[model samples]
Target: MSSSSEEDLLFAVALLANEEEEKRERKVWVHNIYEKRETYGEFHHLFPDLLKDRSKFFHYFRMSQEKFYELLNLVKPCVERENTTFRRAVPCEERLAVCLRFLATGNSFRTLAFSYRLGETSVRRIVYDVCDAVWTKLVPIFMPQPDKEIWERNELEFRERWNFPNCVGAMDGKHVVFDKPANSGSLFYNYKKSFSIVLLALVDANYKFVMVDVGALGKNSDGGIFSNSIFGRKLQQNKLDFPPDKILPGTNELMPHVIVADEAFPLQRNLMRPYPGDESKRNTEKRIYNYRHSRARNTCEDSFGILSKKFRIYQRKMQVSPEHMTKFVLATCVLHNFLREDHPNLLAELIEEATPALQDLRGTGGTYTGSALRIRDRFKDYFSSHAGSVEWQERMINVGRRNTNE
Candidate 1:
């Protein structure tokens, strides 16, 4: 109990505490294999070899090396980070490559972390940051707000390429499945019995996304989702800069520029759905209208098909949060549009020869306004008229009927 004995005891306790703290700090900042990424990572070792073989490079990144650099240059300002005294930041090119590979292969962060020689958490953060940058920088360039001229151009392409008049774009929704988040029960569950978020898109005739609304709950019907989306609200408010009504090709009757969709969407003055019921199928004029509608709407179907097949991320359930998944989906769409113009052959090969028609999610019970009904009628009449009819229309209709009967 002497003062000298107490001082010695206090010194001993302080020495033990310092040793324990040192152990904890060493565990927290331990050196690992990932620290040698500059020498061992795929980006450092394998990517240079890939550049020598263009085909392999394209397959690895889902884009040409040139395109990859171009994209990096575009998004560099947003994704680039400053280095600190502790460590240098991951290069912008490497960050973009990590994101593109994640989207191209849908690989998990653990798998990507090992391949890139980075921490799993670091991989996840890089994927999200690069995806956000891609969406922000590319969307305005690739999928800008459409004005009257853009809408008119799309209408002309639809008429020339798909044989549908007064149509600006084909509208549809795709369910991007993902793992259910904690505490989110049944909100993201769809009739397909999977958790998903809707990617509601309006695709142009050229298989490019004109506008997309991502991150709606899967349980909601496409109609409801579209009605609640920002794009849909702008459409409803007549603020989308759509061209005024114009006369149909070869007809004196004026019709509004309309978006063609399946029955999941309600019929509106600016939207058209096919004539329903067995009665319409029996009528030749109605049959022709449906045929043309399907032909034009097939663009949207093909866009989804190409996107899913090329990106491959939508093929599996994503593991990220819904917010991050939205960014991922939007980035993929921007890339789809960007690649569509320059790499048409590549995208063309991804299209399924016969993508089955999407089922009608909404039954035939909703009321249609008189104006909407009349707009559809005018289109039906136009398709059957001489000016709008293609030469092989009857033959195609007969073939479809025969196939159905058989």
Candidate 2:
């Protein structure tokens, strides 16, 4: 039992371990994909040519390196664990991939992880951490609070083009359906008979989603949805910083600008809706209002459309719980705004051009009416109420006119 014999045995064991490690390394495959699948392929689909110069795309479209590093600094503090139970430690690129996947495809974390190389649990954690970073840093930077001048200009533009003065943005609600929780019954079900969360949003002229509130039960009416929202309260208390004392572009009306929603909201002096009724005459008036309001309100749909188109995840079913959907919606909105800001010219060209002018309206844009106030009332009354008399409807139009004038 000499020393040489013992050393020889130890060396043989070490050599075997080295050979095994080399075999494992040889078996591992890591292929870099420059182009992406049809869905969730922002960098690839929208700007395929840029993939050849990936660095240029990052340089042109992504945030500046300093800002990105700042974002990294914010996220580093939230990583939380030094050692993870998972076999491989999650890298920054992987975490970023989750964020990008959410933005690019709006896919569920489970689906994203399967395609992007990570566990579902890790994907969830990484998405939330990156969201925390973007929500704290990038969101505020990209979505700066609208100033008085911007609001005033928005109102002026609305007045001149749409006959709705002092309108900063349009409000709308969209439903995101999901599987009903056990024993939840009809509670989460909507008119569509599906479990869902309604996403309420305010989008601007540029088709940028500026504000959003998510996680309202699907059963809730759009008005019911908005009433419980923080944005709704802000309007009630006049907390929103609206442009003050402005003349409606074509008319003499003067008032602080407001947000235009559908007939599903309660009438706040600042919120506009169409006239409510069924008589052929009254219906015509309501239609006219809805038409104009739709012109403005349609931006919300456009915002949703662009989001779904880019993320494709929305086209498929969502897999996250109702609560996490909030984060998903918020993150998507931020991403939409980011793309709009970073690639304005591209988006501008991609957006459909304005259609031919409506008849009699003569380029009045789309539609408008007192129907919003009616929706507001219906929502406030929980959707019960006989249609107001035609005379009363006329009076509201008058009041609306006066409100616009004042």
Which parts of model 2 have CA positions greater than 4 angstroms off?
1-89, 106-111, 144-150, 157-163, 182-185, 276-290, 344-406
> Candidate 2 on 1-406: residue-level lDDT in tens?
8999999999999999999999887556333331123343332244445445644444333433333444566566555346444234555644654575565545677666656555567678887777766666657766666677767766666555544445788877777666676676676677766677777778787777767777878776655567678887777777777767565333444445668766566556677654454532344355445445666677766777776555544555566667666676676677677666544454443333222110010011122246544443332232112321223434544555577889
Full-model lDDT for every candidate: 0.85, 0.59
True-vs-predicted CA distance for residue 206, candidate 1, Å: 0.6
Q: Return the top candidate by TM-score.
A: 1
Instruction: Report the lDDT tens digits of candidate 1 across residue range 1-406.
Output: 9999999999999999999999978765725787889999989998889989976787778788778899999999999999975678899988988999999888999999999998898899999999989889998999998999999999999999999988999988877888897789889988878888888899999999999998889888666787899988998889989999989877788889999988778888888888885867779999888889999998998888778877867766777789999899999999998877655565455444223222224433255799999888889889888998999888988996799899
Tell me how far the alpha carbon of residue 176 in candidate 1 is from the true structure, in angstroms, after superposition. 1.1
lDDT of 2 at 96: 58
